[model samples]
Target: MATHPTFITCSSVSFSWPDGTEVLDDFRLAVGPGRTGLIGLNGSGKSTLLKLFAGELTPAEGTIRTVGEVGYLPQNLVLDTALRVDEVLGIAATRAALHAIEAGDVAEEHFAAVGDDWDVEERARATLDQLGLGHIGLDRTIGEVSGGESVLLRLAALLLARPDILLLDEPTNNLDLHARARLYDAVDAWSGVLVVVSHDRQLLERVDQIADLREGEVTWYGGTYSAYEEALAAEQEAAERMVRVAEADVQRQKRELSDAQMKLARRKRYGQKSFENKVVPKIVANNRRAAAQVSAGKHRALHTERLAEARERLDLAEEAVRDDDEIRIELPRTLVHPGREVLRLSGLELQYGARVAGEFELRGPERVALVGRNGAGKSTLLRTIAGELEPVAGTVETHVPLRFLPQRLDVLDDELSVVENVARFAPEATANTVRARLARFLFKGARADRPTGTLSGGERFRATLAALLLAEPAPQLLMLDEPTNNLDMASVRKLTAALEAYEGALIVASHDVPFLESLGITRWLLLDGELRATSPEEVGSAVR
Candidate 1:
């Protein structure tokens, strides 16, 4: 592997949000030329670190140094729909200048604009092609392309810049399988210092190293994400064993202390009895009793100190273990019979995007994965099925109660508490009943009473899901659109865990292969102007 000098360095850096939420404190990181994947749970400061490196945010303290130019692709990239592809790619001026010079304008400013970048257009085209965006012409408006294509276009822009340090945050969050493959290729071929913050396991697998950020500290792990998982598993296992040992030691210390106290009490009783029986002179007996009492107190103090030290050891051992809990809930009321027709679509055509010309049926407790590129109408289709949108062409028939969790997760009332939002769905249930159900979704006690607007992305998602699953009439068919978007790996796992307990028919639209596979999908449909049944293996192999 070719190695370069450290291109990005952060020393004792500190950063906080506008609300004074401390994200990074005394953070130190030095990265050389290679691909490094940054991963952590949500709210662990991964995005903040990238922003700091890109100079989008100033550090509260310490220094940051970089060797050369830097390019950063933020997680939530919102490009103006009115902007043309060339302008978005930052090549409009150069292309215009080249055109002027080619027309024999002989303008000095045009020459200055086209200076050393005479082949800029060709380079831009090549970059676009590399990122699977050749079909998107530079003159086309941004509104003409899909979300996935827009992401690729942005990455192509960064690639055209050819910065020494490249930072990508959740670059594959909205990409399909084909777009993701192209991104993986780009990462594989990158020669400069690249740091990407993503929860995509496949993307992380292509990294040269893994940097796990937890509690404002970074722990470097050699090799791919799988290697890091193996190392972490081993570490967690050892830590748990130590906790068991420490707990046992604490128990033993307490017992020993109790035994010492009991012995001291018995000896004190014997000495008092001897003094009362007048076995020696009264003054000598009293002095002997006082000495015995002092000795017993010293003995008890030593045992008490040992017990405290043992309890401290137990606390330290427990701290070494990670506390990541999966969502566990039961939805027995949502069960569907094997022969029941849950949903049916007959010649349904969406308002804008893809259309279904043929009849489609979903029956029983089938778990269907809806895989498609962005703007292929996956979300529109789900909304149409949920009756949230009126189709322009055909009909959607539902045989049972169904609920849809939109990608935007706007189902909740921001002003209302999580419990109130859930209660809105389950009107017949009492407030206590709603709170009881929300607890299973990890919203116990005051957490259930927090306003929906106050929750983080993951927390908001959980709250929305709770509202959906706890709805009245017990939805027998659940449709989720891009459910894993913006969720960390842990949150995704929690979502999967929560879904596992749902005994209803499910249709989840997502590009995350690992998450889809984990759901035990019995059917796969590719949405590309039409819905076609496909296999998981075909899904993996069809990413051309």
Candidate 2:
């Protein structure tokens, strides 16, 4: 780990949405010059905090200050397709001014616009080249480039700004493998106060430190994301051990309290019996009973206080335990036989004419990874197979029921609740049954009733998955296009757990190598212009 001067600070910062949901309150953070990966569970306000740092969102209370200029790249970057590449790189004015000067029309405004960046054009071209966008000329419109290239173009713009602080929110969301590598190189090369909000483990590995935002507070970890995970695991293990000890102590205190009560009751009974038997003088007996009662009362109070203290300790110990919920659900009905033919693509050609070179067959409960560059038509292929889009040529035949979980997760109705959405898919299921299944997707109790429109990125993804899984007749083939996009690590884990139980054939189009590997993918296909069987190493090499 390294240390640098604090360049960004937030003091007593508080922010809440219009719905009165507080994201950050009395928050305090100071970031120094270095790459710091910002991570948190979904809805924990990672994006909101980045927005606050970028001054895109004003805090409800307190103040934020920065040492110098800031540049921010949002998660959902929407550049006007008609805009030229130079404009996106923010060098249009400079290029124009330089051109005018070269044309011998040296106006004062043109010189001012050019400033000291006389080499701006060269710098811009170099930046674009660094991000693998050199082929995309400055004059080309954004619509002419791929989605991943567009993202890099945005980053190139930020680099051109040369801001003291750079903030990126899920910069690799829609990027392909090669694009991710390009972005990773950019992050590794960054020397400013860089704070990136991302769940990409590979990207997080490039950071000098990790800022774990949890429960509205930032906890600094001394190293990368893996280091943070190791520290967190050790902490949780110790906490669990403490909880066990506390539980034992609480039980001991309870037993002691019960024994004290029993002893006091026996003494009271014996005293009454002695008094009735006339074993002593009435006055003596009265004194003995009074003394005994007072002693008993004190003993009872002491035991009660001890018990309460023990319970409090137990509660505190329990609070230290992490709440890492897993998605647990049975998917027996979704299972497919090993001999069953689940998918067959015969000379399939997508709308954009990225064709499968020959016949393809996916049998049994095979897990397949579809790897390709961003405009390589992975989504188009998946949609065409799902019957959402008609293919340009060839035929796609499915022997079993299938479901496609698109990148947008638009299958869910925004107006409906999570349970309601599931019910739509499972029309035969009762309300209670729908809720019971929804709980396995991590939507339980009142949360299951939350409108789909209000759910966070991860929650919405889970709800969409639940709908697809719980649909009637059970889909034996599930297709997911970049399912891990925008999901936090926790959500990714939950999804992995859910998919673990799925015995259906799965064709997932994703660039997340770790996630794809975790799925135990039986086959890997690279769809550049034609689909071909490939290995992970080949895929990595191709992208690199």
Candidate 3:
């Protein structure tokens, strides 16, 4: 691996939530000047670590040191809608001072405000242009920009500040392909220390190294995400082999212990028989018996010790194997016949001016992928079909029962447990039946009783998905909007596994091409101003 001087360090760090939930404990990290991909399962404290580095959160114990200024872009970027673009860029005052001086105000305070940055406007415009936001005017309000554009704008602001350390948390969560490319370009151009917590494979592929956080510790992998995966796979393979060898050794030890015990019993029996037959004098026989018993005890202790040691080695070997469970669900009731008409859209005019002229129909268990650029009204269309939105002009008809899982995962009630939430969806299901079904969704035992509000990002998603798929009348037509947005790679794989078993019609809106392709999508529809049929190969060009 390439090496660089350490620019940031955390020593003996510890942090916990006010609710007494421990996050990081005695954590130590050294970050150098390179793009590092920080990854872990949901709730692994990747975000919290970034927040600590960015000084957004303080460590309960230990010291953190940074060599230069830090800029952080949180996962949920919430900017005041009313703030002007210049204001958000943190140059509104400087721009105002420059303008005043240009208008012949020439005050001392204005000069002080402007400082040496007489070309601040030019720099801001150039930064915005670099991020593919040149069209967004400095005078415009944040509300005027799209979500993807807003993310880039935040990054642009950080770039303008010329910070030496930058931290981005799930920067590509809601971004479109074009915006993601722009952000990737920005990452490529970064020369300072950069750490990004993201699950986007394409984004992680650009990193110089992988920092895997698990069980309150960070393990460094010497390359990109793919390299890390390869390394981890090799490690697991070795661990499994060791486990097999250890298991064999344990079995061998157990057999030896059993054989030794049998031999000792046989020896005792022979000794007792000899004594009964009076082959030797009573004193000599008794002495022989005492000697035999002592030897048997030693033999038994030796075998027992060996067996215990072998079992201990087996346990250590097993602990090396990872147990990342996958969701395995079967929805037989959701199956649709090949000739069944699942849904139809007639003269569909979505709330955001995107429309489907004429008619659109879905039949049987057809899988549809909704592909579009940001602000292309994909979500709006899905919402319209799901009855959450009143279409400007259209008719949506569903022959089979349907369900929608939105991007926010707000279908769950925060106060309710996972089982309770699922019960609400499937009112007719008995409590025992609900619990049995939840186990298939990977929520067994106490996990099913966890309140929705306290679940992690991945857990919350699974719970919501369970509630939808396991509803009273199993939904035959399911609509999902950006389902993989913030999910980790493992969670994404689990989602794919769950969907593979879903025997129903699916309409998923996503920018993740790999995920879409894995679903065996029969149709690809691009939503711009109008819905149009397209192929997977044509999606990029059509969206661009």
Candidate 4:
């Protein structure tokens, strides 16, 4: 209810796609100063709304008012992969200077459009430095940096816009632990309004509020991420209760309607029998005129009786209710017994070029995490484990039937129907059996028939899990590579629950610190190629 400074406010605002299709149905949100986190499952219109807020897309109806400028960092924004890191920053500085000139605050020859204090190069370098992209050696090409680093560089440019508000879309995707920590720190220190669409719980923990986009509407929750989570849990429980109550009511009304219809049918039958046998024969035998009058009276009575029956049946049927789909879940069976030594690395090493893991060994269900600076081979280790890469090592052995959920959904056949995609994993399954199994994961009827390409990221992840589980027996060992990357809140919660109950061995490598903690993984291997193992407690002690 308070006025927002340096924030955007949407009032009865609506938008449609270029095809004149509706997206937001009079959607409303008050993004104010202080950090606010946006959370919704994929295709919930998070990105589209952010674009509208940034003025990239105009609302088709109502008004969007902004009190101040804004800075937006989009998700994994692709750079001119050909441009050098320095060149990109240099261009950004020039653009900012130009914007200042166009705003009539600076002379065309000087970026001091606002004041004599505007230092374009100094400010640009500072922003880039804060994001840890300064070490790219000025001349280093963007292509030379890893995919994650390039993303960060682009974010640095956006931040330098010096806007009064910030809208970040999935900012943590592909980020390493150090980089993510830096972003958290930056956001914590930010004075402007911040609205981010992210699935990372750790990032949200520091936020002042959380909001969700669902069913073409927005719902805001006060307090931190943890509070929002509690609120959502309570809401879900309430919704389920309402659904149950509705179902019970429907059943009760259905029974009443059925009984009433039967009674009406009997009444109509009685009227027919009374007219045919009791009244018609008497009319023929008695005085023709008197009998004819009696017959007409009986016919009139029958018509009135049938009309009453029809009204009663219609009223009863009107009270019955319709039904909806029920939610369910099923994980595959497991057949893996991890070796006494869950993972063994003997003279193990991974090299993308000049990197090496001298030698290391990990054992048991000890729950080890990989962490390091950017380009430090953290992902490479997981890649090697998932067999996405051939370890340039002595011997890396997984003594279990490992199921690897890759960071990306390359295993999915985009062209196939959702049911078919799951079916392919179980070539021996009948079409009906495959469909039935997939339906448990929320892909039912036409949804199952929809092409895999049509599924949102969360659905795609579920589809992948369903397919993998359909095997004769599930794999005992599970390997998740950046499992939380770009996942929705519901999917993240569902996955965290699944991982917690998983038996055998578990290996997860991710930048999601909160997720790892929630799942009880305390040991981490900092991968400066050494893969040294240390309990999170130990690291905490050392840092302290």
Candidate 5:
């Protein structure tokens, strides 16, 4: 494979949180001018590394160097809602100056501001149009657009700046299918040094290479995410084989050491017996015993050293194997009998002028995927069903105990421990019971005791999921809005596994088609202005 010239370098970089949690220590990475997908498990410092590259964060030690201008889009994009689209796009000043000049003001200052870029507004509009934001006028406020549009708007601003190095962190989090397609198109169009930290499988497939960040080190893999997976699978297979060989070597070394010790013991006994029986002269017997003792010592030392080396080799071999744990828990209480009435929506009129076309009913343990374009009221419908929001002019009737996990995951109390949070949802359950259940969610011992605010993205999701599934009365109706957003691929898979054990009526609002397909969704509903029946095959076109 051809290699691009290196444009960014981090030499012996070290960083830690205020809580003394070491994220990266003496980490070195060199990225060239190509699309590199930075991927890792949650809390592996993918975002932190991107921040360092964008100069949003300074390393505690070592140095970072970049060859050209850098632009960054953070995982959590916070922008002032009052700012105008042009201002957010960073062309407000130029547009203002151009307008002034066009009005015959002829001010030198206006001309200087314009600075040969007289078509700033045209360029801004072009960028927005490219990102599928043409309908969003440049004069509109950021608050007027959908959350997904705001993300694209930020990306548009970065593109307008024309930076040499572009660093994006989880850029497709809240995007719908159409918006995500636009973002993917933008990614495909990028030619400069592009390093994106994302869990979006489709987005990662477009990258030129994959940079797997694990244990404070970056391991580069040629080709896209699928190719990276293939390479990693092969690598792990070899590592496991080495581990088996090393295990055998360790066992053989232990057996040899034991055998040598037994032989030495027998030799000592024989020497003592011969000395006592006067088989040889006393002086000669004593000398022979000493010599035997020395020989036994040498043999014991040699065997012990070999065993130690073998154990060390085994440890190293074992370290090469990945330990990606899956969530495994059964929820018998959440199971609903066949033909059970789970949910009903009568003349459902949701907020923001969205409504269901007619009466809708869900029965038994139906798994439904609610998909739509941005600003299509999918979340509003889920919120209404979950009883967090009041319907404008209709009714949402859930027949069984229900729980909703929103996109923000605000169900958790940031100040409380995971155990406490779960207890909050299931107040009648004892601390021991809650902890035991939390352990099944991969929060064992001290992990269950850590505050929810201190957890990584994946850990927080698990903690929240544990609380919801273990809630009092058990939720037979579960609604999740964009549950897979901002989640790592592993977390997504773990979530799929966890949900597989759930025998409840599931309604997940997501743009992640692959994840939805994995859930055994029996029904697909597209929420545009009204809820309509869809299919896994029609989902791609229906949302667009």
Candidate 6:
């Protein structure tokens, strides 16, 4: 196979919506055969940029140039009709043909678009076989597959296209840890130029570079997401220092300019008349000129220059902070009263269809972590604790005020704006008051008015937390189910940072080991018949 040229290049690009929303300015990005982590806040336009590359939306200004075939994956794709997994992959083989043909780069115009990687079609078959999906019949209907399975099948189809550049947006959001890890492995193995947007920290860390979009611009950093973050922080700190120095200089200049003008004014006003004969006209004229030159506009412009510097520094600082979009639960109030035994379930029983609950003894702070495999009743137990479910015959003792941020954040009213959501959460709050608070979470002004449903997953989580925090005493017990599922790495960091500072207890269930470890989780529980907290290692896949 012949090597391809650069996959894509963007220069002096600026983009925005038809409604006059600015996504970015002077944005630039260059990509090739390596992993690149694409990131930005909810409204940061990461998705918009991808659309441009996909030929779905044209850039409002500037240019985007690319060579070779491209592959794209989107988060939360809706697949209609019925088709088998193998059929989808096979269908993809047919689709790649048009693109290569359109690009006029195929060795042969009539050559099949997607086919065997090597000299045979078996190469493509082997890829699907490795994914444990070889058995899925192409003749079978697609509707039969689970949501996760559907996502996997879609990925397989995209992969089979074998484009030189792949653009993936939240490709891992709907997949389980096992499935997600599998996708990661495929990405790692791929020789194609991979550009992905994901909140998954582990995914971001694997990328060769990070591209940050803000204020209509993109900053390219050399290294992984973490390294880029550290460097950005350092840059922000330096910018802040420069701003401070500039501001001080502006103030001092203002005072000196004021004094000079005052003196010049006095000299001009007097000498032109009674003392006219005593002083030279040239001296008076010179004084008048000097005083005129020192107009208020000049003074204001200096201050404006200083302010511009300050603004730049602030923008840099904000960009660095924005990189981590995960929500931090800032409980507005701290409440305590629960004893060491925040939760206790003895002989606690649970049943789903035909599966019986696992058995166990669990007692600890309100900060309990329910650990179990999917469908193992971890969620069932949480629902039970939240009164969403009733145990068949187990004694239950819980003492705490629990507020749950579910794996799904539908608790947020999609029709309402961020501000509206906050106001509803704290109905007692005035519109101005709610807006002020949401602004702190970066949902400022019109952004707060954007429909909650319009927000990116990261933005939605932040808004959800903001709504929760508005509660007066704050929730004493915070229960999170699959909390890190949709959050990006930056968002996860912010969320964990905030949660770490929280004084209230926490109960979270998730399969993300990295997230669990960062939270200092010690014990785990299985969805057996009852609730039990055990060692972290014990938090393995239990039979449902």
- lDDT of every model, 2 decimals: 0.85, 0.86, 0.87, 0.69, 0.87, 0.67
What lDDT tens digits, residue by residue, belong to model 5 across residues 75-133?
A: 76878989999999998999999999888999899999999897788888888899888
For model 2, give the 10-residue run with minimal summed lDDT: 1-10
* Top TM-score model: 5
Q: What local lDDT does model 5 show for residue 338?
A: 88
Candidate 5: stretches off by over 4 Å: 1-6, 329-332, 413-423, 445-454
Better of 1 and 3 by TM-score: 3
Q: lDDT score, residue 59, model 6?
A: 82
Candidate 3 lDDT over 391-484, as tens digits, reads 8897999899889998767899988888999999989889998999899778898778867765666667778888887786778898998889
Q: Name the 10 consecutive residues with the lowest summed lDDT in model 5.
A: 1-10
Off by over 4 Å in 2: 1-6, 329-332, 337-346, 351-353, 387-400, 410-434, 449-454, 471-473
lDDT of predicted model 6: 0.67
Instruction: Give per-model TM-scores.
Output: 0.87, 0.89, 0.89, 0.67, 0.92, 0.69
C-alpha RMSD between model 2 and the true structure = 3.3
Q: Assess the local accuracy of residue 74 in candidate 4 as a C-alpha lDDT between 0 and 100.
A: 68
Error of 5 at 173 (Å): 2.1
* lDDT (Cα, tens digit) per residue for candidate 6, span 282-349: 76666665665566457556666655666665555554543333333455555454454455565666
Encode model 2's per-residue lDDT on 1-544: one tens digit a residue. Answer: 1233548899999997664667889999999899999998877888888888998889999999988788999876788999999999888988999999999997999999998999998999999988877788999998777667888899999888888899999899879877888899889888889999998889999999999888999889989989999999999999999999999989999999999999999989988998999988899999999999899999999999999998999999998897867666456467788988988999888886699867899999999999988878888899999999999889999999888998867898888777888999989989988888888878889778777766666777778888887897888998999898878876677678778778889999988888898988899999888988899878887656
Cα-lDDT of candidate 2: 0.86
| Model 6 collision count | 15
How do these models rank on TM-score, best leading? 5, 3, 2, 1, 6, 4
RMSD of each candidate relative to the true structure: 3.5, 3.3, 3.3, 8.0, 3.0, 7.9
Between prediction 2 and prediction 3, the one with superior lDDT is 3
lDDT minimum window of 10 residues, candidate 3: 1-10
